[model samples]
Target chain A: MTAHAPERPAAGGSAPTAPAPGRAPRRRRSGAGGAALTVLTWAIGLAFVSPALWLLLTAFKQENQAATDPPTLLFQPTLDRFSAVLGADFLPYLGNSLTATVASTVLVLLLGLPAAYALSVEPVKRTQDVLFFFISTKMLPVVAVVVPIYVAAAELSVLDNVWTLVVLYTAMNLPIAVWMLRSFFLEVPVAIVEAARVEGAGLPRILWSVMLPIMAPGIAATALICMIFSWNEFFFAVNLTASQAATVPVFLTGFITSEGLFVAQLSAAAVMASLPIVVVGWIAQRQLVRGLSMGAVK
Target chain B: MSAATAPARRTAAEPGGGPAGRRGARAAERADGWRRRAPLLPALVFTLAVTQLPFLATVVYSLRSWNLLRPDSQAWVGLANYAAVLTDSQFLGAALNTIAVTASCVVASMLLGIGLALLLDRRFAGRGVVRTLIITPFLILPVATALLWKHIMLEPVFGLVNFVLSPFGAGDVDWASQYPVLSVVVALVWQWTPFMMLLVLAGLQSQGGDVLEAGQVDGASRWQMFVWITLPHLRRYIELGVLLGSIYVVNTFDTIYMLTQGGPGTASSNLPFYIYQRTFLGFDIGQSAAMGVVVVAGTIIVATLALRLIFRTFMSAQEAK
Candidate 1:
């Protein structure tokens, strides 16, 4: 979570430390060019982030204040909107979201880990066919499956249950998890495994005592991504659950009605609903970056 | 070197060093197979129970008329439901709308993300904080994000955007009513551009300096370098970005549904929202199921082709290496 300054080696112990001897002045010129580059980068980043900043600012204002003709930025801040959020079932919705996200993330990791290990280490017969089989499941539109899933849930009377969400979310996250963890597992050097086997460790022991530790960061990354996916998921949580098991996204909908919407209250709720994910992203942004950028790019 | 001879001496003592040793190796191979397979059971069961069975059941239900109000009356209707879905104007319109919305979002996000990535790729003050802020939209819950856009930000008169623009003589725009499709496209792009930006940035960062320097030394201008070197390297990442973005955008319900509920008279409604409205709101399960199957089939075809296209370069590059 700590933001550290990026350190480039000033003079390295390895490789040619300096650019070719006569190129110092050219490097100095490029260093000045880099200063100009920095300004351009900040401008671009700010533009990308403007919309979200607008949303955050809107959440802070009063209903009337937000819509003022000149839109006063220096108005005294109010906690009244935040108070309304607290007055509502904000804690309950937060709890529901936490339960759903944690349960789903745990299920995805537990299920995906072994499957990825199997596929990576053993190289099953017809492996490409099996890999395709799992990946292809994502092609099915949720709309197509929702009716049957809804009916089945109605039959089993688990429609509004958090556990039902856990089940669905586990399935939703497994394919990506398997793909991610398989790559991570593959990166473990074969020499280490051969050494472990020669030392008389059984397969299960080798996995638990060796592979699991090496892949811990991968597991964490996958788990964080899975948690975000589950936490932010709306369609399933909306269509499948009602009051009893409704997650925060559904709870946010309470502010919206046919008659009228309370903008401040809704904004407050939206902020609250988004708070956990924002916190998570803040804490684990590094992991999220690595996890999402798994594929070797350029 | 002397220790290596100890293994040979031990093998000589055992004297089972030919056919018997081969049989033992075969036995070990069989045992290894079971050992390797042992960890795979839970994942297979979980996937099958949660994903595979539900999907299979959806297919079955699509072919059957199972309105649980009369459990005993349910029976297979085959293509009748599919025929009904095809004939329904609402479903067809919704399908078109879905395609249009997804395509618009994919284009908008890709362009915006590429532009943003290009900008953010250089060194800058406050770059780290700026990067985090830019991705805040992606981290927000979808439903909450939609509500904020539709209500607080896009709410014609009281919305902050209009409030900010009013000083420059810009009046409030009825985002949902007058420009329904465009509104949804903007909202979708806002939510998803970070995804594209992150992937493209990853691609950009991986392009080592030597290649760009080589292009520079060859007397290439910055524009030419970007076109000839950078853009080509970004193809795979961009394709993956578009594919993943489309998959979500096509099925997106929360933002559009929350923002417009498929209105100012079905203007913003896409296939997923249409399917939900029919199945739940209109109580037309059979037709909705049929519509869903079509969506599934379409998605599968497009995804498969996109994956194949994106991987071709990667595959050939590997082979060449």
Candidate 2:
């Protein structure tokens, strides 16, 4: 396992060291075969991504053009549907999504960072048990508890409130954040921490001034992963929220019954709803693997 | 943070060396322990409050004969709901569907992910662009992905799937309705394959070149190297991918909801969706709660195995450094 460590850098750093010599020699050995493989890879990539690309294209097409048999590839693009979707009651749901995602991420960071710090830097007793407990909650299917959550929320009069979503989302993402952040915290050298302690730096000061700057990228990566999951979460949003605090996912539920009608409009709405996370995910692609793997890989 | 004051308090209380000093020292040590634990309490408490309390309520709800529509029909029916859930054919069917969906989705996506990871393992023109393209499906909102497949790709007359297959003499097929489970699986595979690919790609990239180069120096064929060396090296990664992927995919709801609604009559419904239907649509709170308990019990069996694998992977990685 230690042998694999040197090849795995921190997230968002760069490609692994193996790619340099590992591929160059192979390509040199079989140039034609490699070229054919590249082409095949490109073809498969295009085909695999075609659905998403088609969604984008349909978003820019007229309703009639969007659902053509041959799929109108060269139609005049338009933003009518985009404007139309936005002109509808889309902003409120978008706002709710933003509130839930941003607030929950912040909450997770606040709560998880300290917990991760305890688990890693200070070395809490039975740290493994605590960590296991956190992650095991993740294994508890949301469906199992949604009924009680709904009933409880109703009793508390917070059923359709954005804060309810915020709290739930925080719980949902906290385990991942704690695990990911703890891995990052572990990467902070023990020598540096010991030096800080020698200098009479308190735990809060050391965390705020010294370690935060070093693991900033990792924290951002963790936050991005949290945002992705929170934004994409549908079950809780759909079941819990109503007109007042429905998130973007709940907004999309309106399309479920629309069925064959408004293909272009549905595409437009889907594009807008998914665009933020899609771009963030693309930019943070390297970190995404580490986050999704709970930092087990890198 | 609170550890700063512990030494001060200790010295102020205990002077020299005796039983009293020992007691003071023990008190200070306990305080230090509490300080270490303080940072963890908020998250632990919040997780417990938000997650565990409801689950406990669900247990309580399971034992009661409660229906939302019947305001006066609430009473204790200990284990009756569980009996009904175990015997209900729909619940059994849904449990089976959940297994099938989770198993097939994880296995298929993992296979595709490995293949894609291998393809992208090498240097190539526009590799970054290609990787981004492959990953876009996963980035798309799951709801949107479901809608895209349902409306834009799987709709019979004008859908792109049949149109693309038309050249091969395939006729129009209403995919979501005709083959609900397959349709859901196709969309899930598209979305999840990228995730598996990324994990496998990480694994491939982490392979030490020295070992592979050693294999090459020994005149090992590429296929021989992949089978003998790369595949074995990828075992842990593949296991991690399958476990993590099943964890997420088993809770699939948005895809089934937006694409098939677990239909043509619960054919594609997994446990989550079925439990949701019983609770919300059927308004059978007690029965759904029972089903939820059953699902959790089943998940515990699988998750215990999964947790062991995950812990092994994580611990080994930690020990690696």
Candidate 3:
């Protein structure tokens, strides 16, 4: 096996000594040692990826093949499961999910962006206290809030309501959004804010014209993280909604009713329900760790 | 006229002496503060309304025996419900299960994550792709992970688990029925390991080149450099992983709900799942509310410690700068 480049050793290491013109770069490990590392890495990498790969394979298998006495590496693949879910009210659930995710994401960003600005840029006297408050809200497990909310919703006659989900989802995501957006906003150059101020722009104007453009990428990153989180949220979606307002996560539970029997169809629906966030997450994975870690790792 | 002129001129010449100008400045400062706060208040108020109000309600409800099922018997019970939950055998079992599951997942995921991160940090080919693949599990929806694990990965007849075991001549085992909490922990660890890996990977990459080179120049072996430098640097990352992992793991309702449904006599039910079962299924609203308070208390304890550690990490980082 040939050795391939791993990490760019550009980080936290001495630059390789300049290579003699006619000689191969000495930094390139080109012997049995390199080959062994390459094989080992592939083995580990493949092992890590096995579950997802198996999920995908199962998604494409026929029902009979899926629960066959021994799992088969090769089978006559079928799209029946995918086609079945397409017609199985997947779209409406998809719609509910999209509406809840998009609406709640917008709500979070609109509210969270300003709060983040205040916290990161022109912080108040009790900035840390305020941030801790936001984080602490998140730490309160949903179990604590769900019963009360359920009771309240029942009284308000809003049980199984999508609008309620939108509101609840917004609340669910707001704290993390504020924390993440604040961290992202802090990355904006103070010099730029000063330059705008020197040009006679006031606070609101500085935020609109100067900060937005400079921090557009950061905002996009924050928004993306928020969307992935809101999209993948399950507990609130399951607990709060009934048929009319059921989100994709709840929709997937229908498969569980049939239990282990619909292995193929279940895998297909699982893939579909997970695809949006999985793709979103993959696209935003770099910002994701930082965001989920509440910007601490960064 | 000259005396009046002298007073006015002195006030003007002092730059900020006039009460009117000082008042104007004060008003402007106040406006600035409001402007800064204007953007923040909407979110803070919204979040507080949601948490504080409902939390107040949760607290109030916990103090009463306000069960919808027994609506006619509604009465202020004053710690009776909490007393019930505290002494309930189910709550005790679930609490123990929570600790077992959370501790195992956090420790397993962090250790595995550290190993993968150290490996991926090396300068080799295909590391980027591998890193992405490693993150695949974390990216998948929690419910999907549970379903996939229960139906596909752990299915008795054909699950990947049994298939892998069969080569060693072991036949199918009803993993969930038999192992219960261990089965759930396995799935949780799979999903969470990537998150820990991401944290540790960030730590590994953040190491300063100069220090690494200096160590290498001093003929530091890989294990020595790792133990003396990398491990110490990753201390907070590991801690962050554990704390965050614990927060999420303690709330491990999704998997246990979908996978085992807290089955085999409530063997695998964590606290959140137990509370969920009580409130939604058993209709024991008062008991559930009491248990919810307990979960919140545990969460607060964990969150406070985590927040303090995270605060220190950032403080130490800024000090380093």
- B190: Cα error in model 1, Å: 0.7
Model 2 agreement with the true structure over A141-238: per-residue lDDT tens digits: 99999999999889999988999999999999999999999999988877797789789998888889989888888898899999999999999999
Better of 2 and 3 by lDDT: 2
Interface DockQ of each model: 0.45, 0.54, 0.45
Sorted by lDDT (best first), the order is: 2, 3, 1
Q: How far is candidate 1 from the true structure (C-alpha RMSD, Å)?
A: 5.7
Q: Clashing residue pairs, candidate 2?
A: none
Q: After superposition, how far is residue B92 of candidate 1 from its true place, in Å?
A: 1.4
TM agreement with the true structure for every prediction: 0.88, 0.94, 0.91
CAPRI class of candidate 1: acceptable
lDDT of 1 by residue, A1-298 (tens): 4221112121111112233232221222256677777766677677666756666666677876665555556666677888878887677767788899999888888778777777766544444455566666666778877887888899899988988898889988887787678766766776787689779987678878989888776777788888888998889898888888988888877755533536656766777788778887776655565455332221
lDDT of 2: 0.88
Q: Where does candidate 3 stray beyond 4 Å?
A: A1-28, A198-204, A257-261, B1-28, B317-321
**Best-performing candidate as measured by DockQ:** 2
Model 3's CAPRI class? acceptable
Name the lDDT value of residue A228 in candidate 1: 87
